[model samples]
Target: MPKVTFVQMDGAEHAVKVAAGTTVLEAAKANDLPMVGTCGGSMVCATCHVKICAADRARLPPPTEDEEDTLDLAFGVTADSRLGCQIELTDALEGIRIQLTSTM
Candidate 1:
């Protein structure tokens, strides 16, 4: 299992443990976190936008070109921005932390 921490824009945080191979959006949804996956984990929507926190940003795999394109439509795009639906959980991401922007 891997633990993911989601920090809301208001500074509230929710941590959830999920199985490997889960998407960040799925984990968030399963735990009732505020992330909104409007496209249901498809790469087509930017509603699942989240910022990879500085501490865990480097641990994630680089985003694909499509993901980058979708992110461009997301509000509050930042250097660390990522669409949660596109991020799959892995053993290496055990303690990943993400910050929810005000976009949603």
Candidate 2:
């Protein structure tokens, strides 16, 4: 299991042990975090937008073309912005920290 940290828009952080193969959005939903995976990990909705911490950015695979296109419609697209639904948990993602964007 990977111990991942999700930082809420309010600057609060929650850490959880996530099983391998789980998407970041799944972990957030399971932990009651604020990510709204409206499109259910289909890369259609940008509701699960998040900013990957600089330190963990390189640990993830680059977003797909569809994900990148969807992110362009997101609220706060940054250099590290990514859709949580597209980030799969793996051994390499242990201790990964991502901040929830203000989608409201």
Candidate 3:
């Protein structure tokens, strides 16, 4: 399993350990985070958007064009922003931190 941290808007943090290869969106949903995850990793929506920690950015691959397009509909997107559905958990990514983006 790989452990990841999710930061809330108010700076609260939650740690989740998930099996390797599980997507961030899946982990979040499993943990009952307040995410919409409306598209269920279909790559058609940005409801699962999150901001990767600057130091952990290298552990993730660049987002696909489809992800970028969906993110255009997200709120408060930044250069570090990525769709959680596209990020797979792995041992190499242990301790990766990501903050949930505001849905406002």
lDDT of each candidate versus the true structure: 0.86, 0.90, 0.88
> Could you estimate the TM-score for every candidate?
0.92, 0.96, 0.94
Kindly list the per-residue Cα lDDT of model 2 for residues 1-104, writing each as its tens digit. 99998998788989899899999999999998888889898888799999997779888888888889999889879999999999999988999998998876
lDDT of 1: 0.86
Better of 1 and 3 by TM-score: 3
- Model 1, span 43-90: residue lDDT tens: 787999989966687888889999999999899898989999988999
lDDT of residue 70 for candidate 3: 95
Which 10-residue window in model 3 sums to the lowest lDDT?
Answer: 32-41
Alpha-carbon runs more than 4 Å astray in model 1: none
> Model 2: which ten-residue window has the lowest total lDDT?
53-62
By lDDT, the best candidate is 2
Clashes of each: 0, 0, 0
Q: Please list the Cα RMSD from the true structure of every candidate, rounded to 1 decimal place.
A: 1.2, 0.8, 1.0
Error of 3 at 32 (Å): 1.1
